[model samples]
Target chain A: MCQLLALSCAEPTDVSFSLTGFAARGGLTDHHVDGWGVAFYEDRACRVFVDEKPAYRSPVAEFLKSYPIKSRNVVAHIRKATQGGARVENCHPFMRELRGQQWVFAHNGDLQPLGDANEPEHGPYAPVGTTDSEAAFCFIMNRLYAHFAAQAEMHADVDDIDAVFEIIEQATRTLNPYGIFNFVLSNGTAQFAYCSTRLSYVIRHWPFSSARLVDGDLSVDFAERGTPADRTAVIATTPLTDEVWTACEPGDLLMFRSGALLRRAHVPVPDAVLATSKYALSELSAVPA
Target chain B: MCQLLALSCAEPTDVSFSLTGFAARGGLTDHHVDGWGVAFYEDRACRVFVDEKPAYRSPVAEFLKSYPIKSRNVVAHIRKATQGGARVENCHPFMRELRGQQWVFAHNGDLQPLGDANEPEHGPYAPVGTTDSEAAFCFIMNRLYAHFAAQAEMHADVDDIDAVFEIIEQATRTLNPYGIFNFVLSNGTAQFAYCSTRLSYVIRHWPFSSARLVDGDLSVDFAERGTPADRTAVIATTPLTDEVWTACEPGDLLMFRSGALLRRAHVPVPDAVLATSKYALSELSAVPA
Candidate 1:
């Protein structure tokens, strides 16, 4: 398993104080000695650094800690591959450009039962390494491009905001059948998240308090954050379990803009097998609120 | 930007069918081949495969594609190191065990200012690699053990559902100050997910239609497998763009059990800054919903 870290604040702030303990797990204490990467947003642009080295051992990871680059939105990941090859190309926190905006993404799961490659209308981007994660990313971007292009033919305002949301919603569901798809993606403007099988979230608001990492000795006081109006949210495969976390039900999709929930869509649960032997456990399963 | 895939079904199903196209992107069709791995959940146990070669070139990845392993829960990942060393150890979808159950995690971001490593109090479980991801995993287990022990001291009900949830929640938030912490975690029975900056999700039901991968040309028809009684959910970094995906707010943590939402908690957000600085862009800022 891998680890992911991110921060979205009312104002850009350095992640130093918080990252201290988290970084130690990479190599100094943890087994994800694989490569790691981080990305921070700066005025509609992202400043990112990726390396095929553990965050603890990598001089670059250290430089980042000291450099203290600040951003309102940040995405990060440490790799533990389950598919493909291990190389720089497979490093996470991958970046892509869409409509002149840089989009960042990282993943922590694998899709088995791989299918044959389909030719992109454009020439193949070609894999640098052999990780299925990167390939999936490319496929997503390529499909998004195609979807946007297809939509552009009918709608001039691709960012009509409403259309973008509707379109994105449709796209996400289409990919669900492929396999477990757990990812974090960001455009300089906002961060989008989804939950399928194994995901959890916590929305931290004004009433902040001191929190410490169970993984390391680092701690942070929300009181030090200056403004109590700041709203920060953290999401993960498993609830970090250090604070109160909420679990999303299957088929629920949510949207976030500026560290707040904007919209949500709940995929309907089919009733075909409510009382059948196939879903007997599910029928008896009562979600603990 | 990287790709993530997972499979959590009522029964075991091979992921290689879907993995083929995903793997091609790294070396064949795309470029994410740093390393590759896949896991199959058989009852409570998971059978996994990891290779350092490009999936397109690796005989192992090929073998898995044709293999039909099945399980109720599975997690997989590919690598694209952004930080840390790119050795065999630094792969995605790391696995561990605690309290007699196997736990797996994968990440797609980087952590800066990594703190000192803190091994789980349970034992000498240490990271083999240097990525912050693994360190985080060990930390979680340690915290769980500590929580359980603390409960034992109070003579609390070890089986108390609320107790388990509370401990997990606290552990998650504790990791935040470190950096962007987004991940997918599973204990073979339940899955946990979170979003720190960017993530999204989508869920599917019985009427599994033929789906075409946006990244590749292959298509799968779910109608052939079973009736419309099946239901599943998916979470990812970005909405798949071609499917119906939901976005998670910056700091929303959620939990999932048996493919359903179990609970939720919102972390506190910081205060909002008055727009005194000229840096504020009136056109881009949108009020959160």
Candidate 2:
């Protein structure tokens, strides 16, 4: 239904090179051309650029290509409009502020029934756009807020990372039954990715080598561009560079902080859900190009 | 401490002409060189450009000057950073989402003790930056959410405009005692402006005349650019154009919807507070150049 890209780094780094190749998929190399968006975090604050235009031809995207806005965390998306109109509001990554922090999310797959069935209860978080992806994000945020509220009522601190991870994992597992639900989320400090069927990531560190884009005639030598202490990771629906990309399994949830993988959990898909997944696969395979 | 600019219009209009003159104040004309930001709303969605660099010299601002991104509501700020560091996080205008709508705010005055004294209690909204402006915004949002929650619990619809206006007015009155508190706020549909000491506005409609920038060598004939149906209202800390501008009185709050003034109120300022306001005026007058 769409494509997602994300980067997390130990130091603030520019993503122009990677973004150039990724943006090609917006209309040049692929057909996710309905709209596109990108968000970059500078410390605890974020700057977001979104356009209801093909990223490959958007003036804003072109400016960003030459302008080096460095960030520690970045999330981007190219939409094919599986369920929503091709309006500016339907563009990702969608952002909402929670617990005094801004959280950004981008989705790459469809979750059909979740859009209507999982109606968000009266809560502070709500979806402004009519997309299954945004509904899912709002649902997750509402759950997180509820969890925090419960913890606060008990007079306990809500910074327990383990507990938060468990809640997110449970929510992702519950939504996976509806359909493919691959997504990336961040709160300026850490990034979380959940793979339902298709996702890959690559980590780069010292002793880096040059890499070429798989889709475009572009290449960058990491050794020339980064310092010896630099560490970075890029995540995408499909690998953008000719590098070692690790394929995430069907139900893998990965947590990353400071460019390093912090945790991984393999949540098994239910047998009944797996049996009906052929329809989901066909739905994804039918993405327009 | 900062300069604020906003536009509300019946039609989607480009603000490049006014923005050119306003941006000059960032470094070229006056000195609000700490940072600058602008937000444009497209329906319920928004695109914002912010830079820690001075606006007059920032490549991002230069790109914006030529890019024709049309919006019905827009807010811009050039910061002098009276209370916060010159970082991206401290830049205005700040944004948060509530009730599925994005709310943007920019402040042009100081609230000295309020920044530290009014530590936000545990709430759904909180400041991500260490600025008095952001703290004030959070305080307002928290109050709005509380009012909405109470209304919901009582089985009342939360869209009563009068009630919402009263709540906002009361909040602004409460903050005015802390220090100078001029601000502009919008939720993509309507705009709210409050003037503690200095602000001005101009309404342009049919039979529009030529206008010249006060801060730069630029002029525009609105009659040549806009249709007879076009109506626009521009608000700024100081008049941007050499036209008949209406000065907003001290403690004046104006609400605008669809480029027309919808409501106005003059909350009384305390005599003691007014006596201490001379220092605030001098601080603003001393803005570096």
Candidate 3:
């Protein structure tokens, strides 16, 4: 239905050729064209681009083919909307800030029981558009403010990253009432990913090899620019083709940092919301199409 | 500074177990707590949840560990703010609307060139916050509207996916003068990713093996649920530990759909901007904080 791409490496590396091929799948070579976006990380920074237009026709896509914005971390998406509008604000690859760092995310499906727009004026972080994704983000930030307040009182350094992940994972389940809940998230130094219904991954380390793009007639030899110490990981909804991929198990959420898997596990499932869509009126429908 | 996790597969799969460990890395067992979000995709729909709270102490994160939201595609993030204040408005994985779809996005790192609150409506999309990332998103949307207007006479299926990518890619390069621009984006069906610095990937299919997380002591035997017919890919800033990873080349732009790479290339860097930060500053400074 949609496509997702990401990179995690021990050392900084560029993903020009592979991404070009992947972007085309949105509407160029394939027909997933609803919207598209891409993000790259340098040190503790991120560069992102998004458009409601098709990738192939956009001059930005053409420019990407020639410019190589190298990075050790990256995330990208091409969309085909089913629930919301087809505008740029509804595009994927949303970003925010927390604890003095930037965070990035993208999604490839629909969500139900999205809470009402409880956009709290909680300081700096705020939504620029309307979407369940933004609402959820705002909700999280509001809760975080409360938590930080608590932390300040406790004088506890919430640096045990695992503790943070646990909090986020748990909060997400509470926000939604129906359907699937899978996602990819990251900061500059580390990254985290989870699979609910569909997800895949591939990693390239010491013995680099040549890889050809399945969509476009392009290939890259990792053996040339990459070194033995350079370790990397790529994740997506489906295999990027031309490369091997690994599937995530049901109820599995994973984390990554410095080009390696930081942790993983099988967790419990959230309560399912009863299906009322069949009877819900158009105005009351989950998606006001 | 932050952590990211994602899942892309051919069918529905739970992400709790894997996420449990990864969640812990963000201030639980490790320390990436600024905020977090996750989304699960089923066919053409998605279930998303986001929390500005640390993944560690939030009851929401705990609930997620117990709940199993499944989907085919997913994206998640844990933040350490690098731009806006640690408020809900500045959270990563911002969302909005365009045309007729819901789009999601998240980012890692920082940038300048933000939206001008005083001016308000730039074109189509508008920023609710001061982050450069949001402004860039609005700019892209405005451009799309303008381009579509210019091509209104032709009214071609103009869904040329590449065209969209080309435009966004160029916008990204132009926005680069502010700061790092790394991020992830999605809109229901496909996902697109790009790198300026820090990005990598790892993919697995058919013979999916076991993978361990680096941030925590957890692992998943993907072979348990995977079938030979299934193919998937995972992309992230760093490998989730057990998998191999590949890096994106400098200035490279990419596209992805249905879990496959379709088009790819390095975006051309303009010599004028390359000559000095003055251009970047000028363009970025135009944006209101």
Candidate 4:
């Protein structure tokens, strides 16, 4: 397992505090010491910084902690090397170009039947690395390509983003039988998050207050950096700050845009996992959307 | 127009020295101050550093000068916008994935008939930014995909790289009439460069000596950082150091791998440019490869 963090905001906001706390888990506070990566989206394009070195000690990570590169959508990950070696290619937050948009994806959990020599069946998209996370990302890209291949010239016509989210939901549900499929994906238009085992999120709006980091001694008052109309949604594998964070129930798929919840759907519990974590589920599957 | 620089080495080598001199052009010595970007390849993957700010004054560019990140294949570009606005998305050294390899490209000249909104017909590839350079790159990628999409399994069987080079050559020839289209492309396996207006290259091998930067007041001895077996081939829009560099004839396409020249082919001169620079061509078209 690893750590995942994502942020969606109404306005482009710097994520220095969140990244500093999250990077500590790569080598300082916790043991996800394999590699780390982050993608910051700006106007359909993205700037990705990845390091095979443990994030806590990486020079790039150190630089990013102080550099305030603002972005509306950002995805970050710290890996523990569950599937592949500690090579730069195996780092998380894999990216691809589709429909004239730079799409980013990162997985926090391991998947089975991957990390082998043989690649899973995919179209147009292929994994450049050997990790299950990259393979899973490519699988989602392939699914999206297949869904829109029949469309006309305007492939970027993802005006109805919910329809795109549904495809991502189905894609995650299809890979549920493989193993933990918790992941975060984005294409600057929206942020999609799927939780199979563990995930949490917090939204900060107008009345922002100070919050202390759970892993470090640093604290920041959101009011100092945000305006009355600003809104920001932060998602992570575990709560990073001493603020109220709603724990995402297993099999929950959440979508956010402009720092607000766009949609929420409870995934249908797979038959294979029905017996193992039954007690973990108090509500029935397909609760609401 | 923009400035482009690329390196292909027998072993992983840090490009800090070259980057220092080249980055100076972004704001210090020259006027390519719109933005800058560089992609450093690490085993089939790459780390890209880009800044919308002037490279001479950017913090990221400052950090890179001191950092010794190494790579076997590297592509860098500093842009002066002509087709697109100075946004992060319009920065050069664009990247895409093809055949499970991270393909990178950087353009150094403006192209005509591509700035308008009507996108050229392409395959699965698309441009994320409104730049003629990226559109030209997508056109090349479409041609390559059209040539190889018919292969059965094993799409990565690019053993016949010459055939791949031929496709790129033809693609360049097809777009030759547009305007200046100098570019450098790589997938870690090999480096391909095409010159339509201006390009130059120099190879440093055994018994390496010192050289001074033409754009800066710095000098370095290659023997201090290289072994006898180390061979570094550098291609740039202009020679960064005061070393002997071979000027590439217009319409020349060069392929290199492991720091050694593989092949070179001169594209047939386009009828549009035949009248303007006929005196420049001393050799016939289709030069020895």
Candidate 5:
């Protein structure tokens, strides 16, 4: 498995502190050395940066650690490469535009091979890379697009974003027969997360306190960063800080909008399916050598 | 009009030298001072960086100047907002995915309003921002996708990329009714440039000589940076160097692939339409004080 980190805030906020700790997982504190990517959302647009180099070693990542690019929503991933090579295309997160809104996605788990092609061919979802994560994102996007097209109401029903949210919950269930599919997707307005194997999150709001990094020595007091009016939700494969994190069970699909926990839809996939995950392969990787 | 720059090379080459001079135009040597963007392509996937801030002041642009991010295809734009607000989404070098390949476009001119909506609504082709440039891009994409769908051969006909090339050429002709439409489009393999007003290019090959930047004091001996086997084509809104640049007349659609001139298709539009352009607004803007 790789590292997944996402943040949704009430206001445009910087992710430099959390990014510092999250980036450490790439060849610093952990062994996810394939590549890393980050997306910072600005309304309907997002600026995405991806590198084939390890996050801890990438100059882009280093610049991000100091650059205060304020955004209401952010998603970052450090990849270990389960299905694709360590190329720039294979790096997470992937970006696509459907119906004017730009979407970004990052995955941290394996799947039981969609088998569109043994070669790196983009069959239906149109993923340029060989990663199953991108395929899964496109699968959900196709489902959303088809949902509107089947109704012969591609334009009329688009304002109903809640419809898309339910479709995502349903699509995650359809993909359950694969393997661990923990991934985070965002559309600038909100962040959607599905927990298939391991995921945790912490919501910070009024009366915030200082939090120390779990992966590094850096500490940031929320009081110094902002007033109590600010709110945010930080999600990751594991807790990135020493703050209290709520561990999500398998098959939990959550939505965070404007730094608030909008809702949660638990896709009840059986626990037995997690048995087929690429646990053996991930465990065999050399850690912090 | 804004400045546009593109590079197509036989090998992965960095644009540090050209970018350094180009970045100077944003709030510096000359006044475009809206925003700037760059897309470095690695096959179908590209790493795009855009800042709503002026390029000369943007830290991201500063980093790109020192960083050697090499790619076979690169496209960049320094914007002078003609239709949309100065925002990242409205930044040049907008990207969209079609057939799994990322297509990036940067336009230097305006168009007669494609009046689908009075507001910033994504009508028909689905542009998230209120820019005529994006609408034009989406319109072309729709025509291309419709061409495949109309034939009932969406998947099968994709292998014939030459068909897509011809379609793009024809589409450029169709868009000439719109006002000044100088733009560059790339899909990692090649660069397609359509010059509506002012544009020029230089092809560098073996036995390269020194060239001096017109916007800056720096000079570079390309022979030191490249070998006899290296070949590249650098296109810009105006010649960026003191070297000989073949000025492209209006209606010139040129293609450069793997450092070689593939073909040039001149889409002749009546010269009288340039009178209707937003030339007054551009000239009225304050230049370098």
Candidate 6:
């Protein structure tokens, strides 16, 4: 499985502290170390750094640790390579442009046979890498494009946030039956996260307290580092900090905008769907020694 | 206006030497200091470093200068911002995914009102930035997509390099009628350069010689640095080094692959096209103080 880290904030925030702990999992702590990538969204554009090297050892990651590139929306991933080879093209988070907005996505867990079946049917948005994660992202993008195209034909303004969330929630539900499908997606303005097997998040706001990393001994006092108006939501496959991180129920789709959770859809995983998730069953049996 | 720098090589090579001098033009040497960006292609993926800050002073650029990230294809740009605002989104070179390959582009001259007219008619590919350069890129991409789509419908293989060049040459010629449209573009494997006003290039092979930067007091002994197998083609809006450089004639489109010139098309500039190029006229008058 891979690990994902994402941040959404009311004000632009630096992710160095959180990224330090998360990146350690690539090689120093846990064993996801196939490759890694990180993206920082600034307005409508994003700057992405990806390397086919362990995040814990990459010089680029080291520079990022100290550079403190600030952004309101950030998504990062460290891969274990469940479905793709260890190449730069296979690194997450993958990015593509749709409707003049750059969209970024990072996925954890394997979709396997489901992705292979669905990918060939998708068009206009196609995978550039031989990864199940990229195929899933392309599938999602293709669905969104088709939905918007149909709406445009009817001369309808499809910018409704609720409608967008509905479509995303539906797509997530459909993919959940395939395998563990935890992912974070953003369009620079809003963040959407879906939990399949494991995911957690924490919101830091006024009167912030000191937080310590779970993967490392590093600590930071947000009260001293942040402004009173600063509000941030950080989501990770596993909690990066020893803070009050709330675990999302399986099949929960959460939407965040301007640092606040604006909407959520709880589409509980059915027993039949869970039974068909062969990759998740294999994951259970293949637990690290 | 902007400054364009690109390198295509037979083997993966680091661009620290040439980029050092080219980046200095962002502030220390010349006055195109609005923003800067550089992209290095690794296999099918690319790592791009962009900052709204001047390259001479940006910490990111400093890291790049010290970090010898190697690649077979590289493109860099320093923007003067004749059209768009000095924002991260407006920074060149802009990137977009096309045909499972990331395309990088940077323009050195303005297209003005013509871009505004042609952009709306283009579909599927659209510019995220308000810059004429991006509009031109989107227009070109849209045209390529349309051409390839038509070819696919006709059951024709669209991988013909000659046919691809023909289409690109046609697009470049059409844009030249608008204004001075000098640009460099690449899709990782090949580099395409078009010169409407000013551009120069140099190819270094087996008998490598010592070279000195024209913008800075830096020199490098290529003989000591390169191997017999190292063949590199460097293209820039202005000659980056104190060496024998071939200036591209007006309306010349050159294609370079594996460090060798693959094709060249000479479509001489028309007097009417030159007379209407107001930005080129202003550029001639504003010759750096």
Maximum-DockQ candidate? 2
Query: Of the pair 2 and 4, which is ahead by TM-score?
Result: 2
lDDT, candidate 1, A1-289, per-residue tens? 4666655565676667556755665666556667877777765446556666787887667656656766678778777666644455467777654443556777655554335442222211223345666556555655555655555546544345445556556656655555555566776556666554444677667777777665566667876774766777665544443677777665566656556667777643334322232332322122222
The lowest-lDDT stretch of 10 consecutive residues in candidate 2 chain B is: B114-123
Instruction: For each of the candidates, give the backbone clash count.
Output: 216, 0, 310, 0, 0, 0
Report the lDDT tens digits of candidate 6 across residue range A1-289: 8888999999989878889888888877887889999999988889899888999999889888878978999999999998879999999999987667788999987775653444323445667788889888877877776677667656543346677788888788777676778899988888999988778899999889999888788899998977888999999887888788899988889999878999999867666556755555454322122
**Interface RMSD of each candidate, angstroms, one decimal:** 21.8, 1.8, 15.1, 2.1, 4.0, 2.3
Write candidate 4's Cα lDDT for A1-289 as tens digits: 7889999999988888888889888878887889999999987779999999999999999888778788899999998887889999899899988878899999976677644323433466778888988888888887787677656555545556887898888888878887777899998879999888778999999888998888788999988877987889999988888899999988999999989988999886566664543443332122111
Candidate 2 local lDDT, B1-289, one digit each (tens): 7889999999999889889988999888887899999999988788778899999999999889779788999999999988889988889999987777788999988785664434434457877888889889988888777787766656543345556677789999888888788899988888899988778899988888999988888889988987887889999988888888899988899988778888999876666667776776666543222
lDDT of 5: 0.81
RMSD of each: 26.8, 2.8, 22.7, 5.3, 3.4, 3.1
Residue pairs that clash (backbone atoms under 3 angstroms), model 2? none
How are the candidates ranked when ordered by DockQ, highest leading? 2, 4, 6, 5, 3, 1
State which docking tier applies to candidate 1.
Answer: incorrect
lDDT of 3 at A289: 14
The candidate scoring highest on lDDT is 2
| Model 4 agreement with the true structure over B155-265: per-residue lDDT tens digits | 545456887898999888888887777899988878899877778899999789998898888999997877987998999987888888899988889999988989999
State TM-scores per candidate.
Answer: 0.45, 0.94, 0.48, 0.92, 0.93, 0.92
RMSD of model 3, in Å? 22.7
Cα deviation of B142, candidate 1, in Å:
52
Interface RMSD (Å) of candidate 5: 4.0
Candidate 2: where is the Cα deviation over 4 Å?
A113-121, A153-159, A270-289, B115-122, B153-159, B285-289
**Candidate 6 has what TM-score?**
0.92
State the lDDT of candidate 5 residue by residue for A222-241, as single tens digits. 87767777999999988888
Give candidate 5 regions above 4 Å deviation.
A117-125, A150-159, A278-289, B117-125, B149-161, B277-289
- For candidate 2, report its TM-score: 0.94
Docking class of 5: acceptable
RMSD from true fold, candidate 4: 5.3
